[model samples]
Target: MDVDFRSGCPIAATLDLVGDRWTLVILRDMLNGKSRYSHFLDSPERITTNVLADRLAKMEAAGLVTATLYSKRPPRREYRLTAKGRDLRPTVQAMCRWANTHIPGTWTPPADFMADKPG
Candidate 1:
C-alpha cells in the first residue's frame, strides 16, 4: 500500500492507515474470532460485500492480516490477524470502554473480551 501520509503526526499517520469507517469495525470482528468472509457479512453493522472486499484487500496489503486459501473450487480464503493487527486489541478495548461509559445504550462487551491482554 503506497500510502501518502497526511502529516508526520503519529495519530494522523495511524488514522491514515486504520482511520476509515470500516477498518476498526473489521478489526473488532477479527478480534472477536470472525475470520471467514461469510462470518464478516453476518456482523450487525451490515457492511456491504464490496466494502468488505476492499477492506480485506487493503488490510492484507497493509500487513495487518493474512489471507489463506481455504477452498480451491470455491476460491474461498480465511483471514487471520498478524501480530501487528493483534496489537490493536487495546485500541479496540479502549473504544469499547469509552462507548460503554459515554454512549448510552451501547452493549457492554463480554468480560473475557474486555480483559484479554493485547498481543
Candidate 2:
C-alpha cells in the first residue's frame, strides 16, 4: 500500500521492504512450506516470537502474504504467500546458487525446490 519509500530507486525501495535481517529468512521458510507460527519458530534461525509477529504483520501489510484465520478458540492464523511474494522465488533461488558456489559450507537446496519455476 502506502509505503514511505526513501527514494525513487527500485533497488532501494525493494530493500526498504525486505532488507531487514529476518524478513528474507522468513520468506525463505515460507517458500519451504512453513506457514504456521510454530512452524516458523521451528526454523533453525530461532527467530524470537516478537520479531516473527512483527515480520508477519509487516508482510501482510505489504501484500506479500495473506493471513487467514484457521482457528478460533485461542485464535490462530496461517499465512500464505501472495503472487507478489511468490515472485521472489527466483531471487531466493539465485541467492542459493550464489551461496552454494561462493560461500563455504552452504548446503544445496532440494532438487525440486531449485527446479520449481517462480511465479
Candidate 3:
C-alpha cells in the first residue's frame, strides 16, 4: 500500500515515513543495538508482537531497515537499520533533548547514551 506524505516539507515527509510512536520506538531500539525479535519484544516498554511485526515490515518497506535470515534451518529473521534509519539519529536525539528540556522533570540521559552523544 502506498502512503502519501503529509506535506512537501522535508520534516513532514520524514514523519510520513517514520511517524507513529511504535515506529519511532522501534527505530530507537534498533539504534541502540537491539536487533533480535526477542530483544525488541522483551523490552521493558512491552510492545505487542503484532505491532512489532507490523512496524518491522513497514520499516523494511520504507527502506529504513533490512531483514536478514540469521538462521537457515528455521529461517529466522532479524532486523537491522539501514543507512536511512541510521541517519535519523539526529532527529531522535533532538526529540529527546527537547523532551528533557521542556518536560517537568530534570531528566538527563547517560553520558554515553545516544541522547548525550555528539552528532
Candidate 4:
C-alpha cells in the first residue's frame, strides 16, 4: 500500500514515486546499462509485458528516464536515466550494501557500481 501524502516529507514523496516492487528493479536494470525494452523484459525479475510498459511510462512521467526511438522499422524505444535518476545511485548502493550484509546468499554489487558515483 502507498502512503498518502499528508505531511511535508521528502521520504514520503520519494516513496510515492518509487515505492512499488518493480520501479527500483527497473532502475537497477538501467543502472546496469540496460536501455532496450527487450533487455528490461529479460531481467531476472521477469516483469510482465503489461507491467513493464506501465512502469516505464510511470518512470518517464516522473522525469527519471527518457525514452528515445532507436528503431523506426519496429518502433523500438530505448530508456536512459536522466540526471535526476542518476542522483539515485547513492541510495541504491546503500540498499545493495544493506541487503548483502543482512540477507544471506545475496550477491554483492560490483565494486565499480557501488563506488559512490553516478550511475
Best by TM-score: 1
**Model 3 CA deviation exceeding 4 Å by range:** 105-107, 115-119
From the highest TM-score down, the ranking of the candidates is: 1, 2, 4, 3
lDDT of 1 by residue, 11-86 (tens): 9988988999999999998998899999999999999999999999989988899999999998999999999999
Q: List pairs with backbone clashes in candidate 3.
A: none
Per-residue error (Å), model 1, residue 87: 0.2
By lDDT, the better pick of 1 and 2 is 1
In model 4, state the lDDT of residue 19. Answer: 85
Off by over 4 Å in 1: none
State the RMSD for candidate 1: 1.5
> Whose lDDT is higher: candidate 2's or candidate 3's?
2
Q: What is the descending lDDT order? A: 1, 2, 4, 3
* Model 3 lDDT, full chain set: 0.82
Off by over 4 Å in 4: 1-6
lDDT of each: 0.92, 0.91, 0.82, 0.88
Backbone clash pairs in model 4 (N, Cα, C under 3 Å; residues 3+ apart or in different chains), count: 0
- Could you tell which candidate, 3 or 4, scores higher by TM-score? 4
> 2 or 3, which is superior by TM-score?
2
Off by over 4 Å in 2: none
